[model samples]
Target: MRSRRAPLLIAAVVAALLTPAAAAAAAPAPAAQAVVASCSAAAWSGSAVYVGGNQVTHGGAAWRAKWWTQGETPGTTGPWGVWERTGTCDGGEPPIDPPGTEDFPVSQAQFNQFFPHRNSFYTYSGLVDALSAYPGFANSGSETIQKREAAAFLANVSHETGGLVHVVEQNTANYPHYCDTSQPYGCPAGHDQYYGKGPIQLSWNYNYKAAGDALGIDLLNNPRLVQTDSAIAWKTGLWYWNTQNGPGTMTAHAAIVNDRGFGETIRSINGSIECNGGNPAQVQSRIDTYLRFTSALGVDPGGNLRC
Candidate 1:
């Protein structure tokens, strides 16, 4: 009973519905293209050595190294490294005030507020000698930058020392492990004395040797200088801060002034265990202290508060 023309009519309708123009109208539109940042700086090289304050480029962004580095790529090395982001190559350098410490960043009262029970042995003023000796310590960039750096530095120290109560590590079992026999210099100060000490609680035999070498002291031979000589002890901490990257991608100083944010400092200090895969509570403790210190100093906490 079907008409012969019915098949032809149906086929014509189907062909009209699936025509190229019809299909094009029915399909979803293509996504907009992403804008890429234009950068002109030379790329970073792993084989090349970079000293403190050296600049390099990676991933279209310019970065400055905090300390000596080789075989570590910027923006990738972490939890044991040094590199600070300056900006995109096209953005140019940020305005940096001439280095000066006309005003000490932290008042004694402010320092006391954070470290209410700080060890009497660790006098705050003694640190001035260490700071004076280091050209970049609290003296680089603007006054605001210096204050933020001071707050960020002490906040981490506060967490490390339990609000500045413990000068040396409480757990003695780990002391002996800090001496790495493989080091060419050897553990000159004996095996167990290389445990955490000073505000940064500098650990390991190599650290003592390197800090001593940088500061012109024999820390490897006389490790107790960190405990007995207050200025020297503080100097070790500052030396670690201003010069050594420790287990971080950037020096603590760079984390604040370089605009990588305070969180980067935490990553720079303890990111291996405290950041990403490690412990959030521990990381938060450091961040909480940083927020308090920054708040106290009347500076914006800045961005990236978490590791």
Candidate 2:
């Protein structure tokens, strides 16, 4: 008989096995309002607006209409959207280049050697497409930036959902239960109550409601929409990347750099076994994945890889 178990994704393995507790514990105590808007989406486009008790300033002169908004307050579930861009503005000041791009150059082969299975779910072209859209995510222009972001994503995803294909499949299977429970967007009646599907494994009724609202879908009642529709899953990932807490709140990169190191960032966003699940080998595996992924991007292993 065919196996009934659903496949895993990068998010599931990371969420299930990595340890983020120590880093989370050591993180600087959150301010009364732990969620502060860093750069206003308005700042990106030069248009200004006041939303949610904050002044949003667009950054780019050419992309003046661009701005960011939180779906909800800190510790709340919601999705973020980039409504428009009137003109272009530099998102932020560019970072100084790190030393030694010459000594440690990354290659596609290296990436495959480490994450041999990435191609199963995300095509090389697809990964490149994702990266090109958000060059500033890890820092623009630098190959190291791409590598770090890719590595971090891969490591965390592997740890989160077991593997890329698995995540997609499992997400498809458990679509209805996502975000329908004690958690704001959760369904307690479902298989896992919080087994919402997709790249970030979006769970909780509030989260589904917000995602549905942002994407203009009614996910609360039809959680399976994410699985049946690949576009929905991709949109959900982008939403998670942009929204979650808020713009510039606590990025996967920043979280990694805080308590332990870059590796820890992978664990935090991906969720750690030790911290979230209580497993050491899983944590070590995450570290190993990080190292291998970095090598592919041609970055030296010990460089100051920060967000």
Candidate 3:
């Protein structure tokens, strides 16, 4: 009886282990979770085979295949299997045009023709960087809107710089008057270094500080950077154009995108000096440049061309 019992006990233990193994076999292995492959920089080619979840770039945009394919392009959807648009290779939508292409609008030759006697250094290339930094430069509105805004901005800049002739303010006598002793920073770049510089002739220590702060430069301490670096100089101009409303009205950016008219921009930039019977000749100069630019762009000059 004891021997029989011992055999039974041993058999019971073996049966327990065998039951678990049988249950495990019957349960079906846990299904493996499907994996989505990470996007890669591999370029798409019509000749190369691609599997589902593969990513590639074509025509400056990224795409992912939904299934296997060889001849189908990445950005198109058809019988070869659908390829979804992922994003740009740089992880965002590509600009409407390359940086230097549509940003400045007018070509170097057009700008040269506009201002033939202009200083060789005050170039379209010199302006691209500054214009790019200003969000209002090209992406402000439609192509027509953009062209008009650009024309408006360049018109003011033309007036300021004498059709891109002067980099620094021409009237040296007014230099020292720009510094404001009332400000707490107190003109770290000295009393006179903040004289108008760049396309809009950025003037005053406080203005220099503000523009430098926005642009991540230290114009307060090194105001001469506006005079020395063409890019920096133009940035100051764009800073003024995009940010400040001056002593008269709305931001030049707001003036154009809102369709408040070019004359409002004149009122915004220098209405204190040029608008409301202040200086008709100066206002006319800006309007003339704007009309010329619009004509070059082959667009209607619109109304309210004067302040």
Candidate 4:
């Protein structure tokens, strides 16, 4: 699963990074060999997710993780933290939103109507607060298209979260596998930390990294922020809706905005895992929610309801 990211204290930082990282790119270094530093393991990155048995070189020392970890500085997370002090690193490198607020089609009252029994963690204010991360979301097309997009997004979220009742993934057994060790950064936060959280149930270390990078949040290290911070949680949902295409060829936003139909949005979210007769019941569940949401928004469900 993927949850991209949000507006929090991030509005200012997100605004600042709207352009290129010119200054960072132009930084000077010592002449060739003098500037080179070699390490046996990769230098720790705050954005990376690391798991048990992974090693990293930091502050001239080598450290091994006792379990999945992230953002825990090699020397910092305390002796009992996930990282264990290994002798010394052979070598390693170490180191290193918001568009605007505007009126949204779905009112707070209506949102409540959508999920009256929803968990308090999924706050209406949080969703409204996260609007700056992707202003175009539910605002890029005609009134009908806008409503459809809103409904589609909320519908999927409702389904994923069981009407927003669950804040994190229920099946803990599958948690450890979300990490992709082959990725250079690995899962810095323990592999289990990335399991589905927030409204979109953001999962996977890479998705946290990508989403955090986009929103200027260090999600890879603080993945729990999704469950604890309502605005961040909503932003992750928007991040997936507006940007990630997932298993489908186009983004869910594109699916609705480009007249591609609601079915394509489903394809983009979990098509490879749940579509095309993969599980007809699940597809129908999503479709049923979509239809209900569209009706609430006073919009046509549109064609192509199946993926």
* Best-fitting candidate, scored by lDDT: 4
Q: TM-scores of all models?
A: 0.65, 0.46, 0.66, 0.66
Error of 1 at 152 (Å): 0.1
Model 1 alpha-carbon miss at residue 187, Å: 1.5
Which lDDT tens digits does candidate 1 get at residues 72-175?
65654443558677667654542222244236677654554566456778666676556766767666788778778888888888898887778898999998
279, model 1: CA deviation in Å? 0.9
Return the candidate ranking by lDDT, descending: 4, 3, 1, 2
**Which whole-number lDDT from 0 to 100 does residue 169 have in model 2?**
40
Off by over 4 Å in 2: 1-135, 138-142, 168-196, 212-218, 245-249, 256-260, 270-273, 302-307
Candidate 3 has which clashing residue pairs, if any? none
User: In candidate 2, how many Å is residue 107 off?
Assistant: 8.8
Candidate 3 lDDT trough over 10 residues, lowest sum: 89-98
| Alpha carbon lDDT of each predicted model | 0.77, 0.48, 0.77, 0.82
lDDT, candidate 3, 1-307, per-residue tens: 2553557878788677777668677787789664433346677665688887777776567777888887654433433546777555544542233355655567654565566557756766668766768866746677778888878888888888887878888888898899999999998767878898888888889998899999999999999998788888888888887888997568888888888889988998889888988999988888988999899877776677778
Cα displacement (angstroms), candidate 1, residue 271, comes to: 0.8
Regions more than 4 Å wrong, model 1: 1-102
